[model samples]
Target: MKIILPVAGKGTRLRPHTHTRAKSLVQVAGKTVLEHIIERLKVLAADELIFITDENGQQIEAFMKRVFPDLNCSYIVQKDRLGPAHAVALADPRIAEGDDVLVVFNDTIFVTDLTRIPELCAEADGLIYSKEVEDYQRFGVNVIRNGIIVDMVEKPDTPVSRLAQVGLYYLKDANRFMQYLDQAIQAGDTVKGEFYLPAVFMRMVNDGLRFRAPEIDAWLDCGKPETLLETNRYLLEERHSCQGDLIDTVVIPPVFIADGVTVRGSIIGPYVSLATGTTVEASIVRDSIVNADCQVKDANLRFSILGNGVRLAGSPRRMNIGDDSLIEMDS
Candidate 1:
């Protein structure tokens, strides 16, 4: 099977931080968003990994090469930036005929047992993962008949189906998928000037392909600033470990302190992640994520996110500060 990741999004919602770095590279729970996604993909053991990135996606390429050196991966440039269908279509040359394809979006991290994939695909034409969410209008919901997905309605007025597509798919016939994707693009079957993968899947559904919508274990979105922090809080529960020896520092449970992090005269945690090279002194920090190489002195922070190389002093408040910022709050 080939794993295709469309990671070319500019992340317009995650401003400031995204202005200087890719959204997938944003740090949360002491790991990058892409790293967390790669952790999930390690179970797949795919034949070849294809990343659809933009022309200016060198940072992603470099980070992947440096961190995941042994990965058998190739990068495809999505020049037009049309939509999901266009992104996956760029990998057509890499996907051979009849090869199984797993398409995953990079803006979110999902937890699903992929061990049953091969077995499930053997019986079905495709597989879609979804989570039952209360906000049905916010997503394209799966319309299921009996046991298979019959249609997908985007932002329906009524609560048709609570199963929201969590941006993960497994197609048994990659060649057929590309055909539908091409058809969607050529027929001008676009929402607003961009082709989407859901339309292609709908076309495939109309042509007698069976798609099973399984219940996903979890779907953690890192699309925007608020969601990123929520994802951080979620990850910290599973990855709670500290590699630091501090003095005059108090640590609560469920926090991640990376190596080279210094915490002195402070109480940190309940849900927090302090990245490497960060120092928290004379402060009380909780429910937040502080990125690498930051200095937090004489402050109390909560439900905040500090990007890399930020320096904060003399404050007690919440923030969404970005990289390399220096803030000296009033006493």
Candidate 2:
């Protein structure tokens, strides 16, 4: 199967960081979100990985080349910020007829038994990975009937089903899927002036396409600053284990300190992630994510996110500073 990664969104929710890098490049637990997705895809031994990117995605291409040099990959430029379905359609020419496509969105970090993909694909025309969410009104949810996905409703006032559709999908028939996309676009079937992937699935379901909504173990969102930091903490505690060099510092558990990080006379963690080359001096940090080459001196930080090369000092306070920033706060 081929993999399609739609990373063309401007990541407006994760500004500042997204201004310089793609949303998928945002680091969590010492690795970019894209890297985390790629690591999972590698297990499938996909034939080719197709990336749908936009103008601000040069860094994504460069990072891919630098990191996964040997992986079979291709890129397609989505000139217009149309929608998820539109972005997927941009790769139509590259997709072979009757090919099974696995589409994964960049903003969400998901964990599941991927080995069941083949089995799930065999039983349905398409498979959508969903998670049970309490706020079903805030998401597009799958309406399942007799264990088959009958419809998908976007933020309905009345609860249809709690199976909120996450950003993972497997289509057994790529050609048919593209045909549906074309029909939707031609018919001007749009919401808020953008074509949505879920609408296409709804159309397909009405036309007798069988879709199965499978439950995933975890669906961690990294769309905003707060959620990204929360995801960082969860991933560090659950997925990775690291030890940083602490000099006269009080270290907390469930923290990830990449190599080259130096903490002196500081108290760090219970959920902090410090990237390589970061130096923390006489500070207290917890529940934060500090990127590479950043310096935090005498600052007490909590629930903060500092981008790369940020130099933060002065009277110890929480901050959400971006990359290459220099700030001084008064106590």
Candidate 3:
């Protein structure tokens, strides 16, 4: 099976960090979001990995080459920010007519066992991974009838079904998917002048294609700073361990500190991940993530996220700083 990862968004929600790097490259729990997704996909044994990227995707390309040097990968530049359906269509040339395709978005981190995907696809023409969500208005939901998805509603005002469609999808036939996409695009069937992937699925459903919605174990959103920190905490707690040695610092469980991290006279914990080469002295930090090469001294931080190479000193109360920033508070 071929896997297509669409990572071409500007990620406006992730601001300062996204300004410099792709959203997928944002670090959480000692690895990039893209790395987290790639690690999960490895179990599927994909034949080739296709990336649908934009102009600002150089970092993604570079990271993939550096990390998965031997993996079969291809890149397709989506020059227009048309929509998700359009983005998927860009990879049509690479996908064979009858090929089974796995499509995953890069904005959110999903944790689920995909071992049953082949079985699900064998019964239906397509498969969609869904999660039970209370806020159905904020997501595209699948309306299932008799164990099959009958319709897909994007952000329905009224409660239809709790099964919100996450970004993972599998199509049994790539050619049929492309045909539906072309019809949807030609008809100008867009919501707010942008074609959506759900629209394509809806079209397919109308044409008598069967799709199944399966539940996922975990779906973590990393679109903004707060959610990113929350996801970091969740992931760290799941695989918690102290990698580096600490001296004179109050070590708290459920924290991740990378190699070369120095902490002295500080209380770090409860949910904190410090990247490599970061030094903390005489500080108290909790529920935060400090990226690589940062120096935090004499500061009390909570619910904060410090980006790469950030420098903080002199009792800054709390911060949400970005990369390469230098801040010194008053004594």
Best by lDDT: 1
- Compare candidates 1 and 2 on lDDT and give the better one: 1
How well does each candidate superpose onto the true structure, as a TM-score?
0.97, 0.97, 0.97
* TM-score of candidate 3 versus the correct structure, residues matched by position: 0.97
- Please report, in order, the local distance difference test score of every candidate based on alpha carbons: 0.89, 0.88, 0.88
**Tens-digit per-residue lDDT, 54-157, candidate 2:** 88568878988999998888999999878998998887887897688899998889989888887876878989999999999999999999889988889989
**Candidate 3 wrongly placed segments (more than 4 Å):** none
TM-score, cand. 2 vs. native: 0.97
Which residue pairs clash within candidate 2? none
Residues 279-318 of candidate 3: C-alpha lDDT, one tens digit per residue: 9999999988888999999899888888899999987656
Ranking by lDDT: 1, 3, 2
